[model samples]
Target: MTTMFRKALNALPRLGVQVVDLGPGAAVISRRGRYSATKVSADAWMVGGGRRSTRAPAEGWGLRKAAASSLCARHVADFLANYEVNCVFDVGANRGQYGRQLRESGYRGRIVSFEPVPDALARLRKAAERDPDWWVRPVALGRSESVQSMHLGWKTMNSLLEPSAYGQQRYKRFADTRTTQVQVRRLDKVMDEALHGIANPRPFLKMDTQGFDMEVFAGAGERLDEYVGMQSEVAALQLYEGSPHMTEALAAYEEAGFGITGLYPVTREETTGRVVEFDCVLARVSSVPGSAAGVRP
Candidate 1:
């Protein structure tokens, strides 16, 4: 009866709940007071049908809304409702998390996910196995069509074209952290070969390549019209020694006739030594009759 009541309470809307981690085998539950919005902490074994465990507290409504809004959810929602986004391109798809999020967010569009790492590609394939609308590709997007050496990390998510040699590398424990050969192709070539049969040319794209976002845009070249909107991760700091700056990459998108619509930071804390990653969305802007090239949307 207690468990059932707790579950029922958790399902109620507007009920504020807080999970407090107490280290090793202990935790606390804090519920909003009946008379006030302030949380009243309590010692509890379990809440919401889960064992007491040390984990981060659930974010407040404000933080949750901010996080969701930062991902350009409003723009995506507008595109889904207004535009014909029948197809979506998820470049550098890490384990298909973003694809799953899209599906969960009511996006009924065909997804083409690309991951360069073999392990990640395999995982992505397994994750999207039940979704018939999704297709997985294990190829790196670059400027040329050839075999290129890629740096692999201990974890597949850390794999990228440019790996850092310093700054607390995560994959240093691996016995063989050298570069591995991988197939690389231009986005235009891949689209021409794979998606040529589709009647529509333009597709909504989401790119999150660590530092190779510009290369992928360059490979698209004159085929920029084939995409209506793009959401990409822009790294502002020199996180990796060989990584490109966000400003340089945004300029490339502007040259390709795209306008920046949104810029959101992924992290909130400024003292963590972590550089802010911007989730940027670019839309194709029509050229004006007598406008300077420097004008932006």
Candidate 2:
């Protein structure tokens, strides 16, 4: 399409036509033409090669209050309720989405959020400012403590690792990235600092580090057992370079004596209906604080 025509299409929102940008080199879609527009866009993408918008409706942090009522969030609420968790360590807590969702889910515990990217950390801090129990730490968690280069992609996609070819091709936002130096710390080294004032802490670790879950878990080291429950993002395919697959991370957690409590898909391939990644929740096997009705074996 010509630039002039594209501009005109983009201006359609003023005329009651909701235009959604599908990303670079893809066609824009109007609300009414969504069905046909998607089909044509998919075909064009396959032939000319363009990334899909991996952003999902559920990913809208602003609508997290609505999301908290979802089955996945309810599962989390039930987990916290049954286990009596008192604190949460939210790793890769971009803009405090998880922590806020926890609150909306009726979790009245302490939350310590860790984030490295300047843009996200600022927003995360602002989000947590009014909540006295929510704290923000401006450092990324990794296997070792050091200064590392973080690849800043579209806010939610920022990561310590570069996006893989598949990742870049799968999501338009992942293709655009700029690097920035960030402070990385091992969780073991900062555990005391994170839990400083909390007495009798029963912590739950929630990790969504854009394919760096295992690295963050490794950073917890032998102190991992201090957390009663844990959640990690696992992928069926490599989104970040050198990232482990789902099996590797799951096996490692299983070996560490945690059993699966919930596995929720984060995203999926539209055409193939194949899950791309998941939020896997696990709890210490023999140490579950209460009855195990919904908890998976």
lDDT of 1 at 130: 96
Poorest 10 consecutive residues by lDDT, candidate 2: 40-49
**Top TM-score: which candidate number?**
2
TM-score against native, each model: 0.69, 0.75
The ten-residue window of minimal lDDT in model 1 covers 35-44
Q: Looking at model 1, how many pairs of residues clash?
A: 0
Model 1 C-alpha lDDT per residue in residues 1-297, reported as the tens digit of each score: 446545544555345665444434444555653211222223212223233223423333333335545346656655554555667888888788788878877887788888878778888999999998788888988778888777676464354555455323433444356677888788888776556457754577788777677777777767767677788888766445566778987887887777887776653323353544578887765422124732335
Clashing pairs in 2: none
* Counted clashes in each candidate structure: 0, 0
lDDT of 2: 0.79
Candidate 1 Cα RMSD (Å): 9.0
